[model samples]
Target chain A: METKKIKLPLTKEDVLGLNVGDMVLITGQLVTGRDRVHKFLFNERPRKEEIPFNLDGAIIYHCGPIIRKSDEGWRLIASGPTTSMRVEMYEHWVIGEYGIRGIMGKGGMGKHTLGALKKNGCAYLHTISGAAVYLAERVRKVIDGWKIDDFGIAEAMWLFNVEDFPAIVTMDAHGKSLHDDIEKTSYRELLRLIGL
Target chain B: MLKLRDGIIELYRKVATSLPPDVEDALKSAYIIEENGSNAKQALSTVLENILLARETSRPICQDTGVPVFYVKVPIGLSQVELKDTIIESTRIATEKIPLRGNAVDIITDKNTGDNTGKGFPVIYFEETHDSTLTIDLMLKGSGCENTGQIYKLPVEELGAERNLEGVRRCVLDAIHKAQGRGCPPYTLGVGIGASKDQVTRLAKDQLIRKLTDTNGAPVLADLEKRLLNEINQLGIGPLGFGGKTTAIGVKVGVNHRHPASYFVDISVCCWANRRGRLIW
Candidate 1:
């Protein structure tokens, strides 16, 4: 697999060429969202003007980062992906509504997301799930955040400036998904071990 | 006498910032075994690098510092109530000093405590000891892996499992399979068997704290642990479920006698992080 370096505010053109198993070094601005974000967008259906961060040609990270405020600015202590599958039910709508081109997280999404990626020319990028401190080093600055008082730290939305952040593409725009394939293959092995 | 509050704070720092040597050793070996070009190998490499960086920086290994579960042992004539209060205060201090992510949430209000403590939060359990020494063991149980733990009521009709050791093996395998890669394997599993639900759940968590290199004291349980681990690795769920040769590093099991009417088994799965440590004074 080839390594691709991406500048953020990704366009459809940027994501269409990528395929599953390719490595990426993403640099630029991205927004962090998790269970609360997905639930709000899907259930509450906020209009474009009401939303705090831009989503057009943007990448949404499934993360709840550990951030601290200093006189200099904000510092991100630990930032890594939470499991993406938990928000599978709401991601397709979020992707289509916001013109999102990239979904970054760990433990890849499901059929709905795979379908949405194929439909919207998006891709799923899987990062090292528990490698929080190392991943935090990539965040040059914690740009801003919203809904901290309402959603709490672990479930709030935050924006960050990241450089050379690493991840692997596990789902691509062509309806290909690495997580799906592994689940099938492993299920067969499990049955065989049980003598089924 | 050692200051119990201060000692507990130190334990929090140790558990969050760095992994125990045995866990680090397992990850190092897992990295070597995974094929160089494969996703499994690459994931392990990042994890190993992260472990060192977390230690040097003294930051959390994972963003999810998780719910702190404390197992406290107090010597005879000591005040258990006072010890409980000390643990709570120490937790509040650690949350700010360690800068840990506040994880405790109010179920009714949907609000975070922001200090990692609340009504029945941090989940502390106390037991009286025989000796003069005081001991405290803490496990920072992350919800991702903790969510994957399964409890089985045996005589499983579908798996064709009976109430025997063979049946226990089947249940453990099923739990691992259901967990897949979501909990972040190469895992260390703790299995507990007993007459009731609560008994096995604690029994299993107790098994998780045992050293990976130590042999099981019971010959029969030891044999089962080895066999179950061998079978688990064969599942090919590898690091992060990306598929590789080493799916799990170790499996430990505990057994308890039960009434003839009931059989329950609990499986507690810890991810690659497996943050656990004990303090004795």
Candidate 2:
């Protein structure tokens, strides 16, 4: 149970240092994106003015958070990770184009995303799925957002100042994946159980 | 006395904010038995803690509060139309007040309604019961787990699965196998077996409303449920599929009379959250 305290915007060295099953408590800025943002980032390849936040060395959280507007500002009600595989198709391109350094999500990505993570110096951090309220407490503030109107609240990219946000590096820059290992073992067990 | 709309809103809030007692109990037992410092143990610990925090803060347990599904039972002559209208209205109120995620999207336009309501949204099923009391069961099923659900027409040669219970068992194991770590297990599976695809799909989802502690009346189904539960947990696809002892905490099977020509099975894969509640008025 080696836990690393990580501060973003990460360097390539920071990503290379993590390994599968190593838990990390990350601080500093995290920008949330999901299906819509991935497609836009990959397809449009927007220049500086379109995207409000910096993607260079930035950690992207694969989330469609439940956010509400408050008198002071916006309140993140529940900030759980969405399934990571859905955005796997666009993630590789997003990572390469935007210089993304870290991916925080649940249910780790597929082979392409893993390969991109290895080639591009990134790590896939797996948070506890559906542990929304608990994880939301770690978000220090709602820094800013873009595409809230066009993409909708859930799909929009919002910058968050999070402190000690907990996650485990399931898919590391070394091309190791805990998900693949678990799936293979479980598939073997399934075959054994079904007598196939 | 609370109005029906108030009751429905409260039901939505309850399910969104907290899981039922049986689910929490199952999670607790699974947590107790897992190896300390294991990834599976740590994940379950976070889940348990999250559930408590949501309860304390009255916040949604998961951001994907899911597509709201309602199972409504009304007395004879009670207007289902009126009840559905109230349900739709209550859904809007719950979306804003409870602050549930606006999940319903326009299939054609690719736009979120931003209120969790749209054409055929907040799926509702109505049954006219013989009794006077009206009851509604609400489930906030997360999309991640729902996508893991599998529907199969039996007698498939690939797995050597036939139409009988033995075949059903094979199909179930395959479904769980394919699901792997994607849906955030330890899962509570609801299996529906019937003659038609639509019928079985509904039956499967209906079975999910059954409590983790409920006992199936049919001895054969109960035995199959017990065996399937044991077998799935044996797959070592523990909490978040990090690998440990518990892949699934409960397996529920609801069988219906099938036609001579067709045998269909649907598996409703529910994540550990398994958020659900009932309102009677």
Candidate 3:
């Protein structure tokens, strides 16, 4: 019922109020995953206690980064966002199932996802597609990898502790969707401008 | 005559490593010039930065180092290379250096290999032309755009040329609408007319490598492209389908003469991040 605006470097007291199109800089822990990782979680059904990363109030990125073995550790060559729509079939279930508060990926969410976001107090964040290298810079650490060798880089489930991960709020919990609202208003404006 | 094996290998290497000039320029220009008030524009800016970072850091553009799609135009009289093997070997090398994600999965066996190189990894299409040099167009197609691809059949009896054209326009709009916030808008449309179901589908996929700025000289098709572009934009799908006037940067139609018994049309759409490249040898 009450909403608040938050700034970057979000602290415990600060709340993030993201509109659908607002560019945001996130600082904190974020997780990385893809279809394989999702299926693996669904099949394994890891206990809440046994889950590799904490899901509460954490942002999960639907991405598969190109990682190569290096002297320091695995090096991220490109880790861009994948289209989130394909994972939509599983996302709502995952958000409800895992208590995830935020999701980061390119492309907007569908109606079902919007509903899930509303019911679950979650938000859908979008980033630039094909901008892996630029995005990788925000990542400060690779915390731990669950089944790293099994799924490989693109398909692997790797947890990342990141800082200032840039994103836009595309869907919100209050049924306020920046994408839907923008499309509606913009179309009306275009129609008026063109006398259509 | 360039040695067949060597030439093909070289061509494959070039195609795999570098992005096509037109495609690269268009993407860069889109980021700079195209402005829709959505994450799409910001994302485009980030994508440009990412591209630069990827090149500078020697990383694959994206982690899902996509399945390779090759379109080769060979000269009939050019005595140069083993085209097929060239594709295989070049793909193999590119998979190693380009470090592409191993996407080929054995459908029946259900096996997973991490490297993006395997049997039928670089899907190659070859055409023999009356010329000297060979032109190889390669596209690193990720699964996101690939999955959004669709094929709709319109029977000739029910939908004649007028209707089929209308049908094509409808299909494009439907795809954009249904794919809202998916397929990453400010995208490109590939339309295939004529040919069998598989043929039409393949034709549309091949056009993914054609740059948005390039236009074939058929007046009818060009007009179709223009009309489809306008209609789809009117849907206000915008960039990334976030709602804007620029849903598609361009629409490309690849037409083939089909049999009279029945006619078919298919449409394939690619996101703004069209990851394709070109090479000649």
Candidate 4:
């Protein structure tokens, strides 16, 4: 699809214009959240008023990390991306409520997230999971996070400002998704390969 | 057996509550090595670097810490002081000290541990294998990989070994296809072949602990792992399914003596992070 690579610290305009085939390296604040945090946002009252972080032009990463203790405090040990589909249930609600501009995670989103992306000028990006140790290094700073202690490393919503965060466009505002294209191509190829 | 308050406890607190040594090394590597211009590569580098920074600065890496899945093999006749209690107590200590996010949910009563520890905390699996030393492999198995697990029951009369083999091929392909950029590709593929549903699932999960470069004992299975690895990569599911040839770095199949009645096969896909640590005492 004649892919183009864009370096990040991307603004809302940059993310909004991206298509499904485009690749981006985001360097900025990416607040990390997963099932519990997403659920918490959706379940909390005043859905519009009391959001956790500044949502304008921000990127949300779907991840749960493996954290280790250090003398300074808790350090992010491994935080590879998690499945993005689980957040599909809350993606639309989250984008609308938080004004989220881009979502970075593994896996593609559902119809709700797609619709929200189209309507909200947002995009979905995929990060390499299982590369937590690798990915965690790009984190420049931990801005803030919910102190929901006792929530395991995988479920906590820790926020961090990052640089050159890797991701690929999976879903764009216009309803284009690399995941869909890959699925279709793979299925077609499987049919031909298997002689179905 | 290591005392819950001492040996095993201390180890679990150390391993379960912290990130492995290699994880930090891997993160640093991704941060320094940069040649590919793809955003996907940069994304991986960023994530890995983030892990390093988190470690250096003392912060939780990416939020979802995950449920602690402890695979403990206590040797037969090896009696340690309160092994189960030790494991649980260590989990509590780690949860509090390591400050793991409480993830265990009481099936009937839903609540947060606020300390990442609670009822049925750290799903522990016990196996009495023959040995004097206990082996504890703790995996902060994320839901991303857990979500990729699948089971298929092929009709013995219809599929047979050829189709059984085909079934494995198809299942593995389907997993990669369906996963696309999901399950965080360039993942470790786990295949379980056995008689029942549970056995196959266990086999698949255990396969995650196998070395990334090693294959199963059986020649056929080894060939299958190679074939599947090649085939899945050809799908262009690359690093994060960004259309590359390295979607999966390794594939391992674990088989059990199935009851002659059926061939139940399952596949578990673990993302490249493959967060698992091994401790022996």
Candidate 5:
């Protein structure tokens, strides 16, 4: 129930102090990425010169926003978190390779991701899954984007300036996961109901 | 016909932004039953607040606006081609006007059409009927729930599932168990039993268009729906799978005759948002 406001480029101490079920309101520079971005970063391994931004201690968001081109520039209409488990295959590689400190998305990741988070001193944040309009209000600005043509709107990487971007620490750096625990208890309950 | 096109856009807007009344009611009741100060309650409150914001702001209720699926019932003498073209045009217009997330992508080229319309986009299921009036039902189904949908060919030896209702019960519960938090519970399950493998899945999805508040016409199916709903909620997979009393708000089951050799059970899961609307022309 603790509400902590954390800045990006998080340190080991910053993530280690958080525990599963703790609520956080993150502020600072964040980059949005999803299925394609994960593949691009880990699988494709773009040339160093093609890398658009530095990833050292960066926070990666699992989001593919609904953005429109306005008279001035890109306008974010609804940007909610996408399911994170889709990127579980490449999360470990991306976290270790990029020196990422935090991952924000919905539904928790799998065992590999949890292990990677523990090893890399990173934490996984869970946002309300379909709160598109509510989450969009927290975005202060859209800084820039990269690989737009290559990945499409849902998969492109967009840098955003978000303030008080709320999420819950569902998987902490200590190797604990709220999702895994819930699944275990719920499964037991299911079996009990079915008399299995 | 132009009016129908405009009505389709409005329907899309309504489906994208406003949570349906039946769904909102279910959510409200679930919130009331959730323990005070529990994580499940907190999650449900967040979802309720999000729905309010979406309605006020006229923005998508979820980031993945999902593929626009239309179920159309046409009267005799109506041109199916004309109706489909109107739907496609309206979908593109809605993608820009309601500004729905450009969800339809070209799988081969890895490109987004950007307007939510592409080859075979805005999936339409047509039914020609004797009634003179035309009715269209639309549902915006997000991928999170879509991914959790399952189809199993019975008898599933592992689960001891057969072709009877007992087997269908086992499969439905298994699907709910597998979904856990991923499908964004509480879910509205649409179960289709006894159709061919390919058609069974479509039958399951078609069941999702039924109003959440409507009761099944068949007595046996209605009883099964009641039992499934009660058992699923008892799993404590509450709001967002955090653990509580309400995991699923509704379960709609549709059954059809099957071939002698094969029995298929298909489940279509829809998250709490349950964005759906209807139009009559």
Candidate 6:
């Protein structure tokens, strides 16, 4: 497992070098969003100028974190990646419209998103799905939030500064997907089991 | 009654943070079987480490704390309605105190209730029992694993499935194979054979509350459970579907008689977290 350290606002060259199964530790600013946030960006079609943060070369995390308000504004009590498949329908459009460089999530996405990664110069990073506290410790600070009232806390888009956040490149900019490979091999194994 | 409420709240905290003894033991054993430096081993190591960290920090073991489902056995004199209310209230308290993720959402509205309670949330099933004391079993069913659950009708020639044990075996294995890494392996599967669609599904979910080490009372079912567990691990789906040994840690099967025309099999796959707890009072 080759380990790579990537900074925010990644370039095409930065993501293109990554391959399926390579490990990565990302640093700098990352944005959080899940199903509703993706819908808001892709279907609602908000103007880039109206958006609170710059989308160019950004890393959008697929997560609906367990958070609470504290003296420090907001505290991420338990934060882990949600299943990425839920956002698959909107990912292609979002990647193109937002100039996204990477997506961090669990349960690697499907073919459409894999094609979008190749087309848009992006990669899909898979994090440990249930390791909430371990992932939360990597979050240094909550920078800002948007659409809390309409979308609720879980669905709201919150920005954060992270250091050494670990993930694996399951879908790379070269049109490769580890998830798809696993499904195919597993299905073959299943067929053999039933003597098909 | 007050003690029971407090006990339920404490139970929620314990279930959210710690893997039960039986589940932890199964996972540890599964980790031992995986080859060193394999992706499956790496995934299992992270899962074990996360369990320890969650206990130490008093945080939820998974970000998706899951919907709380409770099964209660009570004496005839106990008020089922009041007990249901207590469970609801305790769930609300647990949402803030143990800080469970707000999981209940209205399907039509796409609105999260913020608290874990809503119209049909914190599902509680009551059973009348001869015993005087009340017993409660709780399972935190995560969305990831729940999504992989499925029901299949038997006598389908396509899969060569009949209404017999062989058919049951096929459906169960198919479900596990399809789940792969999506449901978070190594998993514990709850299999319900021979009931109506709704009842069979409930029977499958209810089986999940049993301890991993417990065996089915029926001899035939016990044998089937053992066979399924062995065959599932052989699938090589391993932990997080990276492919290795130890796809499933355990399999529990619960059977009920069904209509002559139907042979339904319902399967509920639980991730390695296997968050469950019991309270007796």
Q: Pick the candidate with the highest TM-score.
A: 2
Candidate 1: deviation at residue B172, Å? 1.5
Model 3 reproduces a share of the real contacts of: 0.63
Q: Native contact fraction of candidate 4?
A: 0.40
Please provide, for model 4 over B150-212, each residue's C-alpha lDDT reduced to its tens digit, 9 standing for 90 to 100: 777765332232436777777677666766766666677788988889889888888877776
DockQ of 2: 0.87
Better of 2 and 5 by DockQ: 2
CA RMSD, predictions in order = 1.3, 1.1, 4.3, 5.0, 1.3, 1.3
Runs off by more than 4 Å, candidate 5: A47-49
Per-chain TM-score of candidate 1, chain B: 0.98
Report the lDDT tens digits of candidate 3 across residue range B102-127.
67776666455654556776677778
- On residues A106-181, what C-alpha lDDT tens digit does candidate 6 reach at each position? 7788889999999989999988878888888899988888998778888899898999998888889998888888
Identify the runs in model 1 with alpha carbons over 4 angstroms from their true place. Answer: none
| Model 3 residue B69 lDDT score | 78
Better model by TM-score, 1 or 3? 1
TM-score of each: 0.98, 0.98, 0.85, 0.78, 0.98, 0.97
Provide the lDDT at A125 for model 4: 82
Q: What digit string (tens of lDDT, one per residue) describes model 5 on residues B120-194?
A: 788898999899899999999898999999999999877778779998998899899888888888899999987
Interface RMSD of 6: 1.4
**After best superposition, candidate 6 residue A155: deviation in angstroms?**
1.6
In angstroms, give how far residue B130 of model 5 lies from its true place. Answer: 1.7
Residues A36-149 of candidate 3 have per-residue lDDT tens digits of: 877767778777778777776666789877666768877666667887776777788788888777888877667888888878777887777766667778777776777776
Q: Per-model C-alpha lDDT, please?
A: 0.89, 0.92, 0.67, 0.68, 0.89, 0.87
Worst 10 residues of 6 chain B by lDDT: B234-243
Second chain alone, TM-score for each candidate: 0.98, 0.98, 0.82, 0.82, 0.98, 0.98
Candidate number of the best DockQ: 2
DockQ of 3: 0.44
Q: If both were scored by lDDT, which would come out higher, candidate 2 or candidate 4?
A: 2
